[model samples]
Target: MDKFVTRSRAPVEEQEVELGNLPADPGLRIPISDYHPNLKDKVRRAYLQKGACQPSHNFKKRKIENLLRRFNLNWFNEYKLWLEYSVEKEAAFCLYCYLFKSDNKQSGDAFVKEGFDAWNKKERLDLHVGGPNSGHNQARRKCEDLMKQNQHIDVTLNRHSEQIKNEYRIRLGASVDCLRFLLRQGIALRGHDESDGSINQGNFLEILKFLAAHNKEIDGVVGKNAPGNLKISSPDIQHDIVNASAVETLNYIIHDLGDDLFAILIDESRDISVKEQMIVILRYVDKRGHVIERFIGIAHVPNTNAASLKVCIDSLFAKHGLSISRIRGQGYDGASNMRGEFNGLKSLIMRENESAHYIHCFAHQLQLTLVAIAKNNVHVGSLFNMIANLVNVVGASCKRRDILRDRQAIHIYEALAIGELASGHGLNQETTLKRAGDTRWGSHYGTLLSLINMFESVIDVLDTIVDDGPSSEQRAEASALLEFVQSFDFVYSLHLMKNVLGITNELSISLQRKDQDIVNAMKLVKLSKLRIQMLRDDGWDDLLAEVSMFCEKFNIICPNMEDNFQMKGRSRRKVHQVTNIHYYKVEFFYGVLDMQLQELNTRFNESNMELLLCMSCLSPNDAFAAFDKKKLIRLAQFYPNDFSSVELMMLGNQLGTYIFDMRSDNEFLILNGIAVLAEKLVQTKKDMVYPLIYLLIKLALILPVSTASVERAFSAMKIVKSRLRNRMGDQLLNDSLVTYIEKAVFDGVLNESIIQRFQHMKNRRGQL
Candidate 1:
């Protein structure tokens, strides 16, 4: 016999099988045609007895009991099957046993000869009629036989499925090995057309296309619905392959990284549909001590707040088995919600572990500083506002916007015609000009400069628009725009500010460049600083004079130049350093000597010596006090003045009602002394005060305590994750984004307990 197994079958130990563990047994080796050996013979005999029906002769008649005895089985009329005789079923098994009969025992009556074999038609007719078995019983047996045949088919199918699974595993392994081989050979996995010098069955393009259309790679168009010519691999399956590959790559990297304190750079953003997402990046030391930055993943948060963001970050760390405590640094945009000391995301994280220090994102901080300076000064702010309005008026209308765009294109072409190419040495192509309203800032300087360089066409277009019968608002807007365009300040200031920002950008790149490059950049920074100082020394007074003249020419009031100083401010601590010592002088000159001292003397002590000294310095020329008080009074009498405003009315009334007493005065001085004492008390609490101040400055100046950081993060996210998966779920998207921001620390890295806690939560959820 050509049997495949059990040549030397050892008596198998019938041990109890554990759950998820398969039972060990020698597989059955039943013959193909004789799975039920006697059944075939009985059917053949019955057919012969029905006899001579197919020109073959044989005949037999047997009782159901005799048939059962022949088959070594017992008859159960209730079951309609002759069950195999077993000692286990010897008692009360008629009705009960029939209901629970095994597949082998679930059968009907056996076939028997209906007539004797003869060479006559009568004998055949008699064969058709039942001998021992009824016609219904024979039909039932046929149905049972068919069911047995189907069961055999199912067994074969299951065996084939196992074989397919084994084959698939082999193929997957081979594919992975091939990919690794290519990576080792320095061959990138990018796709190329056949015309690009290579063609292959293993090409990602070919595999992907093939799988997408047919689902399976083998046997073209396996189903009727399958396309005749399909392309692209199955996306779902491809994603699985990619996911597994990514995990494997990550595992290898983790193993190589070993135990080293690492920082993470994390940033979160939203896609077009406004889904909040995050990206994580790793800054870690490799085995060779090289600082490496590898993109880890992108993730999603439920919301763009610090708390929600922290949870997403925490989950990512736990999933990756990271320790957050070891994180040594953090870098994020200036968002108050992100960096706030009291209940901000950074504060919450620091509370758990102190080592994860927060650092202002240098680039972001510089941008905020520039913005603040621009907004704080009235002249500078007005210039930007005018520029912004100009962009808005020009770009608001589709027709005008098109004209501008066309003008830009023509200018670009002309420049190219003149043998000028976009250069990388400095600023090249500018961003497109975008419209801004009265409240908005103008186009970025880079964009404006590019537009100016391409000015000929733009000027022509503007002339055409002006010549047309424009609306009154448009005409007035256009005239104001033309005035700004012609102004020397407008032209010079644009270039000047652009140059300043350019230096800052250069400094940023220089600081991060290669060693030699960084050294050269540092030299450039020094030169730039000198240039800035020279501008301040030489041009500040001139600029201020010009600003005053401009304001006078426009009949606009010059905004108050007075500065306020508070002695209790933490900036006092910084004044101890020589470089910073000038701050105290500035405070005294702008604050104490400017307004407060004179006011204090008039209100409290009329003959105060400190007040007189401060007033003398405040106006050496006495130009302010020399202003005709009677003329100011006459002007106030003639028209509405700020001094007569409702605010002063309340203050004057309050002053009239005040009762000044020596005890009250003494108490006020004592309060001042107490405030001084408070400062003294805090000197020794450096651990608390210094860090708190550091955090406060960082939050107030370096970061915005607004949702702007989260907003910016989402804006970046829109670029990274688009319509392809605009609606990715929170958890999946969050995982994907962890790599983008490059969070400085993995929160779980610092605490084992936290990670375990996370794992426990995950397990509990999985059970549900």
Candidate 2:
């Protein structure tokens, strides 16, 4: 153990090292004028980097009063963000101005070149501050901005920042112009026939060429003339540019959303290649109280089952840095895959975020209700089918459509001349019958409305078809259709549905509004039911009179009100002594009206209405009259994970303070949407003051306004990943869709910034 060398065991401690501060030398006492401009930069750099060398005790000073006024040693203590003292020249200098001031003409350069020596005129410090636009202020801003870690200069930003910025601007400007051209025209970016010989190589390249041919600056630097391979117009480059713009847009959206609660609207459909793809959109009320629906992205899925869809959505959220816990509402279709209680997408999201309430799309639910009622009731169901079939035969071909239109125009002119119809600007315009679809509930309303407007014309077309007789079979069919349509029963059904659906359709349209809020939705729903009930109670005589008058005009027989009701068939078996009024009004009218009311009540139920009313506290309308602190606390209780009992208790007091502050604060006097309201709260520092209130507001904001955004994204999906480009990759398609949908965000992005990002991404052939 003792075999080691003990001979050199004398003390062998290492020496201590010192890292004293850098020298603060003021510099040579040369006159400010004598120092050359080039030499001043070096001298100033050393002194500024060395820092203010204020050794006032060692320096002599001039006396203005009995007290000698040395450079106010304490003045160095103040204005330190920009001021510096120089003991060598017995004067003070602006550390910032000495290093960065551009010209000597303003303010005599006393602080920089000469170093101000007027100790008695210390009040000049006030003068030095000057106005907002003064040179000193400008220099101070440069100093402050440069000192920030984020705004500091780097090797790249220093060496060729100006040149790079200019050239990059030109390059990105060209690319953006090309992208805008394609998006505005709703045209494809790639061409199957893209070559030198081809006249048009798609909208993207052709637009670039057109831009290059016109601008000499652009032509000199891009395409074949471009240095190296920096054509900037290649397919990959175009896609990258578009994707970069999309990222910026999403950043703006996320920035607006902040950490606030938000809702997602999702819809799934098959692409042209038969791939099941899901589209996601964000819907929130902006600060100005306007509904803003942003098309966020599209996800490609292996399957559309509940679990698979949930996984796909989670993956998408993670990829975009979104948290499922922040979810407030989920708006999707009524498909069991989306709305199933235990395994649907809504239930899955709610399991994680119990506050992420599922909303079966109001528009979709209304449509379904109309379709269901029609299918269930024998009277309205057969009536719509007959109308659909009638439209099919009369307008089967272009020739038939032309004949119908011509007949309608003749009837319209006759009606106008006889003063049966008023002539107005839009009234006499050419019109065509819109065919009703079984699935489109609105289409039924449209078809009947059009028929009533062109009732005389339809009869004329049918009469021609019966006489012309392309075939005896068609002639017989036309004869039967004509007889059926002219009957009192058909006329009766027409007006009845027109009145019933008219009430419900108004509610449907109102509910579909993008700006629809729960408060207004409830009012509309109630108003519609009231109107329907009024019609049921008092509309019997009016409808009967209208039907009778129409029958008299068409020469169809009108039955007496007191007569026994009979079925319109060869073999009639009817209950004895049942009056026509009782048959049609008591049974049919009451049945249709009651069914519609039941559907509305069942779909919207009491629970949903209460939730909606609670959310309406976020409504910024009417000077915030709808805001309720108690209700908001109740809203927060829905998310106990976010707000514990203690937080909820604190939230009530916070809510009152927040509302009072919001009402009094000038900045919040005018607002548009919930998103904007959140922003204002953050800006006013109320978010920190009332965290729970802010959380509740954020929750209310993120609740699903509607699934219209999802539909819109799918609509845009068709435009971006069309039948021709069905094989486009998912990420690429998403990038294109974002840019195409949110063109406004791209419009504000500086061209230079995009180009700089592109250049920094990887080494390129050109230096743009």
Candidate 3:
């Protein structure tokens, strides 16, 4: 290194000695003469030639690096580094080519064509090969070779990301478009089927899975061994997008319908996997005064406590900018948590906003009342228990089950051959038996009816078991079962439930029908109440008669004979129609009555008169809280369990005060007036104002009570983003949903400002 450096060092003016003219003194024997002008020029040329040419392209740098490695030359290391700088710059360009420039077919063609030429004409350029052609050709040939070796692999890494976006676009696009079409066409959800192929075609849940898990590879979706070539995004991003989208969409729907109160219907049930979910539905009046019910969402809750449920409800509302102050009423089943006057959900909501009154689900209340009445009747209850036990026994063993199945098949075939549809065939489908809870037992009537329809199969199975299988004890039990099935109690209860079920079912149909007349609707509701009352009366009478007959048959205590002895003193609370009645019997009868009424109120719709009368009868002088002036006046008349003209006049005066103070422009005033009108109806029994007014109040509460409006939007979002494309930028996903929802206009009120507010809030929060 010193010899070469000394020879190539530029000549200093003081040192003009050539190699042959060196001084003799060892200290002065400087080899500066070797650094003469001609020798220096020669050294420079040698260095340049030996180090190798630095190419201007990335491919060439790689090519040179390979060649250098093969030769194991460290001398050209500095020169090689300079080439690396050029390689880096070109590498950026190559990346650009892979992203947006290179065509795979063309890249391959370049390899097939230029590669052969470069290989066949390979030559090291002479020292004079300083022309641009020499360096450019080397770089170009290197690029061609590199492209040939890796045709599409360079772009494959980004494929998954691209595919995810595309999938999101397609799914979201389909969902939005389908929803818009349906909304415009006014199609119901159940009837909203696509023309050529149904959009939801079993993939509806799959799409929801994507949104729920939010771009994540949720369990049960894709297997762990998914190929590297397959590109599916995690559903986490999708979930977030859908959640936000759902809220936005719901807001838009709410905004579109102005000055209209909505009604909320919430029902809670455990799903197949025992996950408790509350389904929220909204009912509102269109311009035509017709009611429309739209399912908003199904929300999973930790528990069904009123406080927790209310919190869930409130959070949903706040998210969508709905104010609870606008709520007018609440509808819930007769579950204690939902309807308990002290700490129930309705009471909690009412505490926040006084108008959010609760109504037991009319249908559910009717069902409850029927079940109670059936249970209170000893004959009916026992009959049902026997049938239920028989079903359990037969259904318990596969052999018995098979026997029942075979009997059913035989019955059906026989009926078909005789050209008659069996009146009691087709019983092998899924059935929802009435479930018992804290307040009430199962509907004995429904169970009785179910058993009767399956009686043939049940009897055949029991006969087989008694004749062909099991021990003597089993035979004896089977004999008892046969006796129970044949008992008059069983036959009577079976006919009773069938008739009651028919009535209840018809009542349900009337309530659910959109075009049923208001008068007819009220009549049906009223008749349902009467049916329950009549059943309760019949249950007691039948129980007494049947029990007495059974006692006589079994040689047990004669209930009828005991009833012949009457108590001298009765409870003071009893209306003394006859002092001969037994105190225990009156208490027992009243107990049964109260239980039946409570159950009936929960299971079916009841007339206002029946409801109030029952309440009056139970708590004749019980104090009811009166917050509003109208309620106070209304309560004043019913102070002693009956309405009076003086109280009606007082209520009228209260309404006058409310109306006098209410603003003409306030839409809420219209609703307030309706509430006053409802108060009047309780006295007048006009019935006209009650149904419509109740409906109006229901609508008002549902709209602003909870943010269930956001539910549909989320469903739409899930439809838009599925497993195939889950990852989407949050902003983009939100934008797509907002646009879809804000299509409807309300008195020229556009949602642009609202959307902007949402975005601005999001941006500000993101920075923080």
Minimum summed lDDT over a 10-residue window in model 2 is located at: 13-22
lDDT of 3 by residue, 515-562 (tens): 222233334667766865676566556555654554454343432333
* lDDT value for model 3: 0.42
Error of 2 at 487 (Å): 2.6
Off by over 4 Å in 3: 1-249, 256-259, 271-276, 397-399, 412-447, 468-479, 512-522, 529-768
Which residue runs does candidate 1 get wrong by more than 4 Å? 1-157, 160-207, 210-239, 396-402, 405-445, 469-476, 511-531, 538-716, 731-768
| Candidate 2: RMSD to truth | 18.7
* Candidate numbers, best TM-score first, in rank order: 2, 3, 1
Name the best candidate (by TM-score). Answer: 2
Give the Cα lDDT of each candidate: 0.38, 0.68, 0.42
TM-score of every candidate relative to the true structure: 0.44, 0.71, 0.45
Error of 1 at 589 (Å): 20
Answer with 1 or 3, whichever has the higher TM-score: 3
